[model samples]
Target chain A: MPTLIRAEGLTKYYRRPRRYEGAFGGLRTLITRQYDEVRAVDGVDFTVSDGELVGYLGPNGAGKSTTIKMMTGVLVPTGGLIEVDGTAPWRDREKNAMHIGVVFGQRSQLWWDLPLVDSFTLLGKMYRMSEADYRRRLDGFIDLLDLGPFLDRPVRQLSLGQRMRGDLAAAMLHEPSILYLDEPTIGLDAVARDRMRDFIAEMNRESGTTIVLTTHDLVDVEALCNRVVFIDKGRVLYDGSVVDLKATYAPHRTLVVQLASGFTAARAAELLGPEVPGDVIADEGPTLRIRFEANRISAQEIISAVTSRCPVTDLSLVEPELEDVMRTLYGNRTIAV
Target chain B: MNAGQATCSDGPLRNLPAYLQIVRGRLRIAMTYRQNALFMLAVVILQIFILRKVWTALYGEAGVVNGVALADVLVYLTIANLQSWAMQDLAVGSYLYSLVREGRIAFDILRPAGFVPQMLAHLVGGTLSMVLFATAALPLVALVGTLGPPASSAAFGYWLLSLFFAFGISMLLNLIVGLGAFWTTEIGAFGMLFTLVSQFLAGALIPLYFFPDWLRTVAELLPFQATTFTPVAMYGGQLAGSEAVQAIGIQLLWIVLLAGAVRLIWSRALHRIVVQGG
Candidate 1:
């Protein structure tokens, strides 16, 4: 299989100053310059194929940015191998840059003072784009991003949403095959986030533009990603389908049962205990709620068994989401990556 | 994607147009304020007119000082001021330093635009401010000024050549400083020292003739003097006949040397560009 990106035994370490708190600490450390080493990205191996949209998730300070930097060839790894579009990214940067587009949520790639069209026109020259191709891609971006109305306005004057849209267009102007977006939808309102998600999904679908996204917004992953990689403390804990993740970590499928008989909470717990090692979440008069690992047994088996033994009136199976899965996987440090 | 032209042996040349495109985009942003351009023109004229009155007084005591006539000095000031106007933040080190400080330079590394060219485009964006101001100021100063003897065509030609060379050398020097951001923790010490040497050696403060003969000889050999002295001397008609022609040749040599130095520094600097700040 042809892979768009691959990493093997990737690790990144940084030496940083450890300044003591309080005034005059700077003066005290001025002569010595005391420092400590930090390992942001530890050894890990992963790969993403062309047309793959992967969710790269991690807790804050989990070395997400470090790994990203190594992938982008912004920082040479302290150890290991990284290849993007079949090239050693750091060793041959100028060649690699031609095939990738990057957008950072906190920093804009567009010229702040220039009108959107002016920025686009200049980008055409920067990338050595053919006039016809530049025009074609430009028209596509303007239409895709709905930038016609804002084309003439200076970027500094754009609203946050408008600027992000313009920035997205600017990032795509060069027609790069792979798009690396770091927190692309950060700080956006619900409507804007949804709009951004729709635009990204459309792009990935239409062009097969391989996308690797790192975001705090779970919705960004749910809306677009079929596969996700979970990282913590600079190590990859999980790399698989999103569906499998929910089925694995978030195993406790909720069974919201509409009870027919008015049974006491103690009586329900006793009855449910014999069938499964599950918790009785609630017993409100005639209603009963039970939970069990979806991975350990089939939902159908549990439902049929419960109905056969007890007077079960109604029940519904609920699929756990990424939020619940992440809580379970990361909540306890007992399991290490 | 072109099969016949697949890689570095071919594509960098193809990519050159992208750099030019970025510069054009910045130039458009510089054009928005017609009122500001007009306003800047008026202010430059007023400042130059006031300075002329001071020069007119100093000339009363002597026809010339150090062979620089009062009228010549005013012209020199105008050119020197323009040199300042033409200044571009030439350091790649500052960007690297800020990236290290903010830890954001990592983001730039992942993109296809190389750090150096990406930043060069940013520098060109700011050039608009100074270029606009300088362009507005120069013409008006010519209209109102007490006449120095007109610059000979050779002098004017050399002056234009020096302007181009000055830009190259200045960018080269600043680029070295910018690259310094990777190793040096503080830019102030080097910045102050570099500025002092540039001011005295480049002849921005006064003509190089006023320096001791030995010092002037040393300054002439160094590339720094070419930034200001070559242009001012040529524009002020300080050099004449073959001397003027030789000066242009020297300035071109300096430009070549500085550009070569910058290319060497860029290669070394890339190895040290630590972007994923802890």
Candidate 2:
């Protein structure tokens, strides 16, 4: 796949005016013209290939939205280079706009008073799409996003989920090659979130649309993204496959074992000596949980050791979740893998 | 490679149909405020009526004051009021400001169409709707008394031309003020100041001829006079021969100059533009 989006040494510094406290201080500050500079994005580098769904995950005020603004040409970058396709977004906004579609989850792009279909028609006209092309795309989206029920209703009256679907459909009406979605699934119910994730995955699979999604929802990243880019404090901490991320940062797995009647913790510990390499971390009411590195010991070895002394009833293995991995990665500010 | 580029690369001529469609949508939305439109039209008519009565009382039955006939003053007031309604596009500027303040200006920049032209088209549509509504309300007021037809067919025709450029100049001025939102949070004060200054100088209140020499010179120096007073004066036959030619020429020059200024301001605004909060 060819590289469709690229950012190298991307940086942005926001200069905010310093506010004064006292009544006379306001006037004095105006005369002094004091300002404070905050670095929103700092030397970030990344790329997205054609037909790729990349998740851009970051903490709050971590320059996620700032980078998106620069990429979409809404704000000029204070430093660094960014190219969507072959054009610099800020330098050549109109030309770059032709190839990209953007959706901001919190803000609506549809007209508040107009019907859903009217907004679509207006966008089609804005994009100069042919009637046949527009109709075909609208029809497909109407069915896919289930927007038929609210087609004629004013956008202001629709629920958040319904409005988001309408917005997603509207953004793709032009069928641009790339899509930038900032928190597309934010504030959605569980059902709606699942539906949205499925639709996004399908859009990438079927239409070959390169998607760069910024989201705080880890489920959205886990379900839809093949690659995850972890950013914190205006820098990229990790950028790799989702599976590789879990394998590296999240190496520990747990096993929950249920013992039969008359089982005792002393007996269980006595059977599981130092040879059975794993920790008997918890012992509560006829059950014992063991934690171990998956690469170090197999589940079979721990189960056999525990059952040798006490009657084992049932046991289940647990894998390390992405949430745990991400917590560790962000909290420590170090890449484990 | 060009398949994705086909929609937006057709150039301005080919995009005319799309722009017209946007204009139609805007016009429909504007027409939805029928009650407000009617109320505004009534206010303008009542304003002109009261002014006519005051001037008539001042003339003391002579029917001519300051070398201008009472009927001519009524005509100027009526046409100028209508032109003022037609140029009441301060909402578009405020809309631009809100979009910036709310950080939704992203949609404007991300769309394939250029931002300035899209806004200008929206302004044109809204202005046309206001003009039509105000024009339709004219006959009802004219039926009362004291108002007459334009001086001649040529003057009526030339007035339309001046009114068109007047709208252009007003839209550009409003846009310039709106772009000030990018630089400072005091855009509301600027907008109010702009309206007060423009209305006073444009002869919406008093005729430029009534102003003292220095005041009249100041009024003429600004483009506000060209928007309403110049067109109304031309329509009433007050500005004849070379005077009319110069008035229209000044209007054309202001349109060109202001349009250029808007372009420059818009470019700078986009460069340093900060969209606050999502």
Per-candidate fnat, comma-separated: 0.47, 0.53
Please state the interface RMSD for every predicted structure, separated by commas.
5.4, 4.0
For candidate 1, what is the DockQ?
0.34
For each candidate, what TM-score against the reference? 0.83, 0.92
Q: Write the per-residue lDDT of candidate 1 for residues B95-201, one digit (tens) a residue.
A: 55666556566545544566677666655654655566667666566776543544887777777777777766666666667667767657877876886787668
lDDT of 1 at B71: 72
Residues A53-136 of candidate 2 have per-residue lDDT tens digits of 999888777789999888888888888898888778888887778778888999889877667888888788777887778889
Clashing pairs in 2: none
List model 1 lDDT by residue over A1-337, tens digit each. Answer: 4798999988987877777668887776666677877778888789999998998998787777778777777778989888898777888776777777777787776666677777777666556666677778999888888899989998889888988998888877777788888888988898889889998898788888998999988889998999998888878999999888887787778887776666554566567676565767765476667777766777787787677767767788776878988888778655544
Q: What is the fnat value (0 to 1) for candidate 1?
A: 0.47
Question: What lDDT does candidate 2 reach at residue A52?
Answer: 97
TM-score, chain B, each candidate: 0.74, 0.90
User: What lDDT does each candidate get?
Assistant: 0.73, 0.82
After superposition, candidate 2 runs with Cα above 4 Å error: A259-288, A333-337, B1-9, B53-62, B143-146, B185-189
The Cα error of candidate 1 at residue A81, in Å, is: 1.0
